[model samples]
Target: MENEWKIDASESDVLIKSRRSLIDYMSGSKNNFKGHIAIQNNEVENASIEFSLKVNDKDSNSDLKLIDFFENDETPVIQFKSTSFQKVNKSINFLKGNLTIQNITKVVELDAEFIGYRDYNGTKNASFEIIGNINPKDFGLYYNSYSSHNGYAVGSDIKLIANLEFKNQ
Candidate 1:
């Protein structure tokens, strides 16, 4: 329990956002996933996360994207493994990791901030907020449907935002 933390799925969230050419319609997914974080002496040492974004999930509004855009059947789970961690300020930090999506792995940087550790009902919890953006093309999601007066049907960049909580274990 000294150097390891278990993800509290009940208290965590993974949200992705992207827009389409039509100003009114936006494509995105709000997922609840599980993962772990390893720390030593208050410094991040390692981290790993795995999550399956099922199109049928209640929070998923883009079923067409799951089949045509991402092809979730071939690659069910999206994963990330941390390679390095850097502290930019007292609360802000950087996580360098490889994100594997649809069998394509790319190195990505995640901006993370420590939300402080506190004891809640006798349980010690550490929380963090991470944000980043990735190009869908990098992960083989290159399908594009252009509109006449507008731009491409879908945006190229997908923004990822996560709020995660881990319990000392």
Candidate 2:
């Protein structure tokens, strides 16, 4: 599998699967949430990967938004933020006199670090699984009835699925 057109990922290519609840919020709404660099070219090592992964708002569609949080100061310690759909959603009740709560779709970004680098293989592609939250309120979604409940609007969870081909060049 290491012939080189595409490389398969080994156990080491997984990097680390981290759950970052906090990001800029504007930059986490993307499908290609992460990036990778081939550490080997023609079986020789030569590349570094810099990437960021966007958590799922669950929709897996065009109705996604992101917020970005960048580092502004230099410190030996690292700090990150965490948030959920509740931050952007509106609650709706059918009691005749209630605030209109709309659902918000919020895409969160996760942090991943490459654990190690290795050679390439057609069967050795890197795969990632990210977890995050989405709020319909941020996107302004509402339910027609609160009593009926529609049965589907129970939770705000998102997921991301990807098939990556690693090429060492």
Top-lDDT candidate index: 1
Encode model 1's per-residue lDDT on 1-169: one tens digit a residue: 3478887777776666566422121122344466677776776655665444433343344423434564436534456666777776566788888888777899999998877687878899988777898887888875554643234455678777777788887
RMSD of each: 5.2, 16.8
lDDT of 1: 0.65
Q: Give the TM-score of each candidate.
A: 0.68, 0.29
Question: Global lDDT of each model?
Answer: 0.65, 0.27
lDDT of 2 at 124: 43
**Number of backbone collisions per candidate, in order?**
0, 36
Give candidate 2's error at residue 123 in angstroms. 3.4
Which candidate tops TM-score?
A: 1
